[model samples]
Target: MAEQTITERIGSADQVLGVSRREIMEQMIDFYKLGDGDGMRQMFEAYKNWEVRYRDGKRTIDETIELAKDNFDCVARVADGYIDSGDTTVGMVRAVQLPKSTSGPISEFYRKTIDYQPFDPNRN
Candidate 1:
């Protein structure tokens, strides 16, 4: 019915400066899917465990997608930069760029587990 505060669910350290930690992990998985890195998947498994531990389904899914989008956007930005600069290192750097808040669309079905902030589906 209502979103759980970070304290009630995941701890505060996992929260990024602007985005939720769950979002970060989810996005990293997406990045892994896009050939970003294998670590993302590993991170996903870890987060999944945390999801069970905290009973934080909503936050887990929400953050997962957000992180995916963040990773994708970061890579896209690196691609754009390389396109403009003709430098290869930029792409390489993008490969290592961490996930962000604007990752992807995690299912809201998690409402049963924890409180979630209403996200605008239209916004990435």
Candidate 2:
């Protein structure tokens, strides 16, 4: 049988932009070989599905949000990055901080942050 194309398997901008579903699966296998847990597998699958859903049917802005809410819930905290920046009395930047677990250190844990863009010295 002919090998399936990435586009045929996962037709998503995420696949087009960077790695593909097959690649993600391969990476997961590698991680598993190294004794990774089921949690990692779950994360990879969830992330991949979200990417595919996000790219489905030329979705609109509202549709994208709805799709995202439906697919990935654990990492949805990232969307809440902008907590109380402007107009709010507190003026505090809120974010979701993942607790330290078997996955990794607390410092290395994923957290929702207002600053999405990478640090660029030239931009300033």
Candidate 3:
């Protein structure tokens, strides 16, 4: 029961970035382990501006929302890494490929904002 509860909590962070929640969580854990602040994650942790943050439209995940893809940023990015060994990760989503791999923890990470670029949304 306890284990299920823990999983349930983690599962709340559904992966809409095309990357599995587990994979994103692992990368986030690893990054935090190294003391790196995933600024992107912090910004939209608890449904904070999540609707307008990703796309721009009805912001409802119903059958109607699907039809609004063209009007919104429907096609989001995939989760990967800023840099990798080609075996563990692939390309970056944003940000420069820092030779040090600081952002490497989530370079190609799109949805979770752990990718190569910073997850700063211009919700202005």
The candidate maximizing TM-score is 1
Tens digit per residue, CA lDDT, model 2, 1-124: 9864332334334444354433543433344445544434344445546555556678775566544333322232222221212222221122224321212211112211111222224453
**Order of candidate numbers by lDDT, starting with the best:** 1, 2, 3
Model 2: residues with Cα > 4 Å off, grouped in runs: 1-17, 42-49, 52-124
- Model 2 — TM-score against the truth? 0.25
lDDT of 3 at 62: 45
Give the runs in model 1 whose Cα sits over 4 Å from its true position. Answer: 1-59, 91-124
Candidate 1 accuracy as TM-score: 0.28
Query: How well does candidate 2 score on lDDT at residue 18?
Result: 53
Worst 10 residues of 1 by lDDT: 104-113
Model 1 RMSD in Å is 13.1
Tens digits of per-residue lDDT, candidate 1, 10-121, equal 3322433233543453453344346544444344334444444444466566575555444434544444334445564654354346232222222121221123333445
TM-score of model 3 relative to the true fold?
0.25
Predicted structure with the largest lDDT when compared to the true one:
1
RMSD of 2: 13.7
